[model samples]
Target: MGRGQLVRQRVLVPLFGDVRGRVISWSSAGACGFKGTRRGTPFAAQTAAGNAIRTVVDQGMQQAEVMIKGPGLGRDAALRAIRRSGILLSFIRDWKCVESRADSKRLYYGRFILAPLMKGQADTIGIAMRRALLGEIEGTCITRAKSEKIPHEYSTIIGIQESVHEILMNLKEIVLRSNLYGTRNVSICIKGPGHVTAQDIILPPSVEIVDNTQHIANLTEPINLCIELQIERNRGYRIKTPNNFQDGSYPIDAVFMPVRNANHSIHSYVNGNEKQEILFLEIWTNGSLTPKEALHDASRNLID
Candidate 1:
């Protein structure tokens, strides 16, 4: 292996299985050893499990392999805690034992017993619409997510969603087609939308098309479609507070939820230097595209 290749250590805790002597089994590679804690309680389980992983990494470990085998909630949490602490986890193995008896009867559901009746009028709305749309593209570079349809239509949607796995595949496809980033920087100024969707929820679970003047407008200047990724684990971002009905009488059950961000990175290889800088700006508004304005100014500053 290379010098910087990750080294792995395993923190095996049971989710639910046979009775055991201790809460965890602590193992290490550079120096092989094991430690035992006397309590099987959840908190104790996490404490012991975390310490076991810490022991391996504290002695210079880069990655850990986790094997969770139990019916307890704490097992998974402990693994996540360890992962967030900067140790790369390589593998997770679930070792569950099952037993079988010969004296048993098997039964299937009623619908399964009756073979599916495919002769009835099918739901041709989406299919017919798709056929007309497909005809429009006719040999002009069209791809299908799946080869055939299934009885339950939901299965096909998943296959379609897989075609563009990224969050904004539509925008990405257009930028590539325009060759916007090939020679110079490009800026896209979008308007005429009532309210833009959340950055995390921009893409839908279906096959989508991107065409200039129809989906996005083509620009004479170089186009730079930048995607930035950020995440907040607790996700506690908000902008307002709720007021009580009866002159400020308050109860203890009110709460606000935090929003999550997508995992994105803005990378550019301008003329093979591979070190171009990116500037990010965030703006919030009630009824206007405030972020778009800020992005325009920021892009000008960095690339102009």
Candidate 2:
């Protein structure tokens, strides 16, 4: 017999097939009468796998090979259930597929699981961590830009495709990292008939750009574009104010949140006499910091 298991974030499906690759039986946690969030639990997956294996066992199936895919809590539980079904297992394979991209940087994403907490504690921790990650984590961003030729934000240069205001907006999207604190100055001096990206910016040794391919502006003709930028590391958002601009420089609203998104889910399970809960947390970042680092700093901030 051949078996396949598809484990998703909220569901588990097990399939049984004959020697010729014909599907003999299939079952899912939802089909096993598990409702709502309970359907995603490992216990529900265990029940589903047991039920499916029983049907195939009665049909004269003996040895089986299993293939499991995706990330979910049900993966290991389903495998255990299949093992306990009295069927000899030939092999078990875990499969994962990663897409290829032109960019050299890998996606910054992380998942964490915390378990065996008392009831109601998971939600409290989740809320606190989410707030800390989104509001308290420090990041580097361009807070001001200066150009001698461009007097104001609305001014436009001859060869540049974007206006001064638009260029500042694009600069705001650039993700940067720096080891040192306080404000620093950087400059971009590009002579175009070409595209200008984050890579063209001249930064200090302590600062680095996260994504070099991030587009800043396009120049249709050969013209010198010289601009100075002021970078700062801080937490949360900073609104533009009159005091930000000086000389020929224009102020840009800065965003210092390194974490792009964060969320959590709670799963409950029995722990002897008392019921316990598990916290599943996921974090996505802007490449300036890893999710693990963000989580650690957030937890530290909470402790402080």
Candidate 3:
């Protein structure tokens, strides 16, 4: 064998097991210069964990299983740093070393008191909590228009659509999908006037009127109708197909207006130049049914 081959064979390799064909990297507070009382601090632990993961990645490591030992302040901090590093973690298991049951109890009790006082110099925990509160929890709202009829003076269907859109904008929760082409998840019913029937009113895609009872009215009187919309909290627009309407029926062309919440206002650039609040005030209808027909049929079912 050549001299180079002999040297390579003699080199010592750290044994961290096959670990499911993954590279193993580890660190402790002591390694990051936390001495004495500071060794158990969360700050030292986070720094040490970050350095260890970086070293492993430099060695071409892509994923890992983390086995954390000891009940130290850095336990959670180190884990958070590892997650933020973008390395895929298979699993995390505790390998805590306990001297006795009494010692374990004391450590556990101490943690509850020391947790708030640790004052770690990191924002990971704060960011995590914020994401959980804002992104995890969802809210919903439903608005019903009781026997509201489109005025006969409405010259075009666009005028009626615009009025409905304005009413939706006054809501606090967002309308999921509204566009110039068509509205989704919005139901309308019209009845009690002219030749319009329940079937004549074209609903938005994925939207339907649950109640179908008609209220009698003469041709001279305005049609009695109801309009109900379901709204939800979302960071961006979400498209949904409501379970109520699924018989291949779809809404006429309409626009969705923005909710009138100051705190939830979203700003976007207009015409690629001016920055403006992304808000819509009116909805326009463009489908098979005319505005009068929609109002007539909608009056059939009154949403309680």
Top-TM-score candidate index: 2
lDDT agreement with native, every candidate? 0.27, 0.76, 0.33
Using lDDT, give the best candidate's number. Answer: 2
Candidate 3 Cα deviation (angstroms), residue 100: 6.4
Query: What is the per-residue lDDT of model 1 for residues 1-304, given as tens digits with 9 covering 90 to 100?
Result: 1011111112233221111212222522112222333333445545655656555545565654454433345555566666766766565543222321212111111100111101210122123222322222111111111112222212322312222223222322221111111122122222322222232113222311222222322223333222221111111222222342222211112111110111111223344533332212122211111222222222222211
Model 1 earns a TM-score of 0.23
Give the better candidate number (1 or 3) by TM-score: 3
lDDT by residue (21-115, candidate 2, tens digit) is 45677677767888776876899889888887888788777777664434467878887887888777776544222221222352577777655
List candidate 2 stretches off by more than 4 Å.
1-107, 242-244
Give the candidates in order of lDDT, highest first.
2, 3, 1
Which of 2 and 3 is ahead in TM-score?
A: 2
lDDT, candidate 3, at 304: 6
lDDT (0-100) at residue 258 of candidate 1?
Answer: 11
Q: What are the models' TM-scores?
A: 0.23, 0.64, 0.26
Cα displacement (Å) at residue 209, model 2 = 0.7
Q: How big is the positional error of residue 52 in model 1, measured in Å on the Cα after superposition? A: 1.0
